[model samples]
Target: MLSIPTFPETDHQIVRSLASYSDRELVSLHQLHPEQGKFFAALFCRYGAIVHSVVQHAVESQLQADYLFAIAWRQIFGELHRVKLAADPEATNWQNWLIDITGNTIAQIEVPPSAQIRYTLNTAPPPLWCYLERGLDLLPPLSRLIVVMTQSLKWKDRRISAYLQGEGQQIPPDSIPNYLIAGYQQLEAAVPQDIREIYQSGIGKQADALN
Candidate 1:
């Protein structure tokens, strides 16, 4: 039996739903509350690379994509209500508002005439396998699943909590990072390659080789 996910509505529909809220509710929720910023950040953290992909696809160079992605998030937090929001208010359409800003920013900004294109290997190196292993061991057995989901699979904190909760673990929001951090430490402590004894010093050396 295939279980289909139930999305409340499409992203565009979300925007429209949000748009339909009373102006007072929107103003209070978005403008007047300090906690609103935290909620917005949670959304960003949850949807990071996906939202980033939107920027990448909309722009030209990787650097430009990075820059615009950053600016979009910044604008979301800083410029809340500063610009006219979409009349449609669909989250998908609302995203287009940010996309338009990126396009417009590029149109106006000019640098001295230059023509060069270059690609570089990704600068962020993969985390050491040893460190990751150590990190995993640090977590209590029950907590390991959520920790892996967050750190490795890029699942968000709430999703991880839900997963564990479903499995009868009853994880609290505050403890998610603790599991991941401990797992990271375990991986960091992997036995050094050279010092790893395959033939065994704790046991007697192989008889024929020594003879």
Candidate 2:
């Protein structure tokens, strides 16, 4: 009987170096040396973003997505050894296989109602949260801080201005709203079209549910 392979205890440079291997090559190495976690670690590092994207799209909120994402990876790690590359060119990709596994794992997991994200009339879904996070990175530092304080922390314009004033920046409270508008406009432009579509789709779903 084959023993289960151990996962990497921590990410290291040596494991990360295996990222250069092709998907098929990595799978072969993992199958050949199941105990060597570097190969699987390489697979995770290569495809983690896409996996998280898939999970985020399926779940209602970041917290739910994160929970399911970790569970999905655990399931993937367990079954990855049995995966084989198909002969069909389109079907042979590791990404396609991984996505299938992730979807199946998500479908099977029974999350408690309290753990699920409960959307309301005012709440934004995971897509917007993701888009806003990426968009915030592209903004000027002050604008990002202003937007976060205004929207996320629910700070009033005067409070934000006062805070900035204490920090030695003489931003008047009257300019706070303009800064928020400009920051939002920059986020709209800086976020890619595809991500924007996902954000819009999330909004549409919420609207339909609310109505």
Candidate 3:
């Protein structure tokens, strides 16, 4: 049988000490002292934002993100005892494991009503718009959401961020433009060859008009 570690009567110092523990050390400590809330809290405080960001990126509604966050943490705690150390003790497998869990959590959510509506409306878009939609679909979920909101809905980055924040996501305004650029790149790369020229022409015309 594995030996479980015991905590002292005063755990406050232990909690503080956990703050400086390496990720591997933390995992080992948690495995030994599964009953200690401070160890779990320390891990959560260290990686909660990352998990939240991943969930927010994949989900549109705050409610859904909140739900996913809770599920992710619960799963993390439940599985911590089973985590195996990598050959490299310094590797960030723990964080990666959390991100993978977050992705899985997002996958369990139903497609949002807005996304469904957008898909329905685009069923018979014009040829150029058809290609645009296909390209948008090739983007990662978060990037696709950002592109649709920015280009199709004509929402400003600040507004987009605000809307996401209202839904419980914490995406900063500055990050929206980066997501847009990534979405556009995915679109450019994935657009069909036959429609590529037309797409380029349309973008060139738009650029010329702005200049």
Candidate 4:
């Protein structure tokens, strides 16, 4: 059986300490303190990229994507209390639920014709890094975290294993590569083919610099 970890006493500490929490626990904390943005912020950090990616895929311009992303999150914040889960293993999946809300929000929003034309004529598609960002968001939480630590933070597998173990996740250093392989595969698959081509064709330095 998995043991429940105790949260820190203060809101700030709790916020910083939420990296190891499950989605259900985070939602429950939000429900308990709806007045506190910190709880919801944890959820946002965990899945905000996925929400942004969904909006980006739906719209043509970054302007439109940004507009819809804000609206989607506003709707999500207001409706979060409606999310309920049973105690059983087959209970509601919070990630799927959040995705559904994002999709619905985007569907309800009609992009302005003026903005569409303005962006179409003046602005190029967002940098390739944006798609890569979205691809990382599409990964499972642990996989995403490992990839970010390894690639962005330059942490080795042993260090990542130690960090996870400290956080009550028992993944060993040897198994870390499997997670990286799976994460890389999912990331490549999630990004658009054209974007991948552009990124791989020697513009990657510029793209990485954009981040």
Candidate 5:
């Protein structure tokens, strides 16, 4: 990995240049300009290793890690403007923001097929949660809606409530799990043992991807 010295006293002039540029300055520059080729290059030099470490930790496989790193790089390009303009980019704690970005990127990785992240119940069959997620497709319309919004999308209860209200049925936050649970139970009755394993593993990794 290339070493670009940390800002303030770093031999990297781009680092020094950005160190003096406020978050607003960087944001405005990005917003008011045609592109951020040079600006992003400086940031990549400054934190590329940190980002690589993050992706490597999640994927463990070199090939997959490289793929995930490429995905993160693309995200940085797409979202760079938002990050630079974020509330406190100029502060000394700027690296924290970068770390947060990298960490979020890591969480979004899909664990491979061999990994079943949740606890298994028995050798004869997989855990209950495995069947539950698979059953998601068969659930009652409103129940499936609640579970997907609350669990998969991770939306706040208030937003979910509003959405439900728009659908002409109101449900409290406390009842969300019940709806999901009932849906899962029905799904369990119908799923094959092997199918349950795959469903459970996929959802767990999907949730991890959100971490």
Candidate 6:
């Protein structure tokens, strides 16, 4: 029988303390102390969901998604020491780099025929959550960013506009809603008909329940 290793109590405390560190700081810590797994754990806890979302959108089956998710982490772990943060504290280069790595991993995978056929026939949706994620991926980058920030991150329009401006793109607050509307329109058109109907039905049910 094989034995699994467990983290020490002190490592747990280290992970907890590292949660206050920013993404760049966490990456720096991991690079500086490659033996300390807690720093990497903290970084994964912070950004793993985003990575999972990307993998989910790229692959059809949960099994495939899970396999690719682990690969993504391995790739990130192998490459973290090479990452350089920008001088600007608010730069999103670290997050973008992780996303790029996941994209590259996805590109290397060959989708099985059965999954492709099922998707083509619109007989099955990948998963409830994946419908929206796939749709989000189909949108133009700026529109996708706005929608993800608004929907997934629960950021307000003003905040999104401010963040974009800080990143050097000056999107007005009043225009955010229009971008969101356009994003959903693009999403609806990009997804399969059955998936779109299912998503719309869920939204309808939620609205009905709220009334």
lDDT of 4 by residue, 78-177 (tens): 6887788654546758878899999998788887743433232011123234445656677899978887787666689999999999999999999999
Report lDDT per candidate.
0.42, 0.62, 0.58, 0.63, 0.51, 0.61
Q: Distance (Å) between predicted and true CA of 20, model 3?
A: 0.8
- lDDT tens readout by residue for model 2, 59-155: 6655566556656776776677788886554556788779999899778986445343343312432333333454567789997788778755668
Instruction: Write candidate 3's Cα lDDT for 57-132 as tens digits.
Output: 6566554454455556666766777887674867658778878776776776554543233322112112333345
* Model 5, TM vs. native: 0.37
Q: In candidate 6, where is summed lDDT lowest over 10 consecutive residues?
A: 202-211
lDDT (tens digit, per residue) of candidate 6 on 164-208: 999998889999999878876776565555334333443211211
In Å, residue 22's CA in model 3 sits off its true spot by: 0.7
Question: TM-score of each candidate?
Answer: 0.30, 0.46, 0.43, 0.46, 0.37, 0.46
Candidate 4 least-lDDT 10 residues: 1-10
Off by over 4 Å in 1: 1-28, 43-51, 57-64, 83-93, 109-211
Clashing pairs for predicted structure model 5, backbone only: 107-209, 108-209, 130-200
Mind sharing the TM-score for model 1?
A: 0.30
Q: Single out the weakest 10-residue window by summed lDDT for candidate 3.
A: 202-211
By the lDDT metric, which is better: model 1 or model 3? 3
Cα lDDT tens digits for candidate 1, 113-210: 21331111121101112212333455567555654575446688778878888888877767878776654344333322211221112111111011
